[model samples]
Target: MDDTSFLGSYTVGTDAGMCCLWQPEHFAHVTSYDVWEDALGNDPAIERSIEAGAFVPLYLHSDGVYQVTLRTGARTPREKRYTTASSEPYLLVSKGAVALSGIEAVGADLDAAETIALAPGRYAVEVHLIDWQAEPGSTDADGNAVDGALPDFVVEISPEPDPAPPYRRTVETFDLPEE
Candidate 1:
């Protein structure tokens, strides 16, 4: 029997080249620039966490609106033409929900945003990169031909045990890019 179940799906937009699923309460102080410069920062630990599925970073090649689908299951979905970029664990702490938005939209009013409700705990997130232009005549479910466009991603969130220590992140400082 298939244990996977669809939770929700959303079309999120980003202008900062990245989007993330975060516990709003824990990220109240996050600035627009902090998302990439501080949280990601190209540090080895951060990279390791990303590999271990401990920190969820949805990095995009370029900025635009993309489809994000959420699901709960033990097995990751196997897409014939898509690439499984990475799957990592994210330690989510919240009253009972999490917010999905572009880094620039973090602290804004998200009441109407794509907020996912879940029991506070650890969850595994998998990012799948889809390149529709790679295949000629390929089109998304909506029948739109996004030729030569940046890749879109699908994130899967599932409950997981706490990851081992030393996998924690220390947000390092970095120079913000000139706008």
Candidate 2:
């Protein structure tokens, strides 16, 4: 399986510790509330969005600049050594176009986002965690600094006509109190 079927690559900045791949038309609906804030705190608002098929919310481990690459075909790239961090199903309900941007850029700085066209439907997103431990002082293939222990990721999106329900979460920032 060729994992080099690259669709696009983007450099996104996240001050809110999260980013998302969403359809432009559904931007207003997803951002209608403070989904970004909720995502940072791991609030229920994010979960609601996930269940409602609002968008594909990514909870980054740290708040900073990260490289996000979009690809099709094989989930993980064969060229680099990456571990399967998490895989989730995403239901895209909008036009055949989507944009990748920091959650904070929703209404304020969407102009700085990277947009791509895709068949609007259900898709699977597999997040691959880059292993920087092998080369302690070296950078990744994308020239990103490997000194920091942040869990950066590469997301592979593929068509999933029948995505299973009850999506699982990949990243969680807080723990819920015992009810």
Candidate 3:
């Protein structure tokens, strides 16, 4: 057999009602793109769609809390959300993948809560048991590095990347006390 584990097989659906791009429900989980313009609404329309999986953001916030908006469409038969592999760690990349001059973190088994605390910066995070793989590289199940056989995983957290920030952002604003 070929080492097809490195190659991914994703599909796109048509008629949506007639043919499914892939059996999303079949996979452990599936990710959906947000169709709504206002991602900040929290009505039944938004709350109903987010059940188990997660709202894989099509965009990112320059700053502050972010919301993912989704609307029901033929392209979106059901509410789609990205399923995080909480059970494992981030994926691995060649040492070359890391930028020798950028800010990055390298460690083993870094907690999600702790990682979120880092200021906006690039990092080469290493985790013997977990690395928090984002995407593309994350497609590889072995990227999680359960045995810690891989070297190190490099992640770039720029001012703003194409997708959401490489690391997850959880910020909460508060009201200041009145004088």
| The best candidate in terms of lDDT | 2
**Best candidate per TM-score, number?**
2
The candidate 2 region of ten consecutive residues with least summed lDDT is 168-177
Q: Model 1 over residues 1-80: C-alpha lDDT tens digits?
A: 15446666677888867676766665554455555356445557355444443335566646988777666653333333
Candidate 2 lDDT tens digits, 1-179:
55356776677888888777766665554353465455434556555555555557666556887767677765443325554355455554536777888766754335868878777676666555555444455577787666543345566677764535545543342222379
TM-score of each: 0.63, 0.69, 0.16
How do the candidates rank by TM-score, highest first? 2, 1, 3
Q: List the global CA lDDT of all models.
A: 0.56, 0.60, 0.20
Q: Judged by TM-score relative to the true structure, which candidate is superior, 1 or 2?
A: 2
lDDT at 32, model 1: 59
lDDT (Cα) of model 2: 0.60
State which candidate, 1 or 3, has the greater lDDT: 1
Lowest lDDT sum, 10 consecutive residues, model 3, at 98-107
